[model samples]
Target: MNVSLQIRDVPGEVRDAIAALAAANGQSMQGYLLELVRREARVARNRTLFDRLAGKRVRGLVVDDIVTTIRRGRDDPDRADPDVA
Candidate 1:
């Protein structure tokens, strides 16, 4: 389900600028505004996720070190597996 949104008392210059941008992009004002809202929502969600992850530590598991180890194994398949023994 979707709800309607209404904004009141937009200044003329701002409205005209947005209208012009919408027209230039071959979209109706509604379509352009809807895309803006959706993009902003995605950005907000990403920000919230990053905020939740901030300052949390995983002991002895550096991401760069892991990637390097994987790459080394891929590049040299004859290398002994550290976890095998």
Candidate 2:
């Protein structure tokens, strides 16, 4: 199911700007606004999700610093085992 929104009393300049942008992108004004809205929503969802995953013991990263620090009981090559035990 889909519904439409009505934004009233918008300034002429704002409407014109939206029209121009939509034209530049070869989309209708509705498509332009929907795309912008969808993009923002995706970012919001990612932030909320990653925030929830934020703190448990994690592995230290290499390369461009992506992975978090290593949790205990994980054998990393950098840490040598004692007596090969």
Predict model 2's lDDT versus the native: 0.83
Segments in model 2 whose C-alpha atoms lie over 4 Å from true places: 57-85
CA error at residue 79 for candidate 2, angstroms = 20
Model 1, residue 13: distance off in Å is: 0.6
The alpha-carbon root-mean-square deviation between model 2 and the true structure, to one decimal in Å, is 7.9
C-alpha lDDT score of every prediction, in listed order: 0.93, 0.83
| Deviation from native of the Cα of residue 10 in model 2, angstroms | 1.4
Question: Taking the tens digit of each residue's C-alpha lDDT, what string does model 1 give over 41-81?
Answer: 99999999888887575678988999998898878978877
Best by lDDT: 1
Question: In model 1, which runs have C-alpha deviations exceeding 4 angstroms?
Answer: 57-64, 71-85
Cα lDDT tens digits, model 2, 1-46, are 7778789999999999999999999999999999998899899999
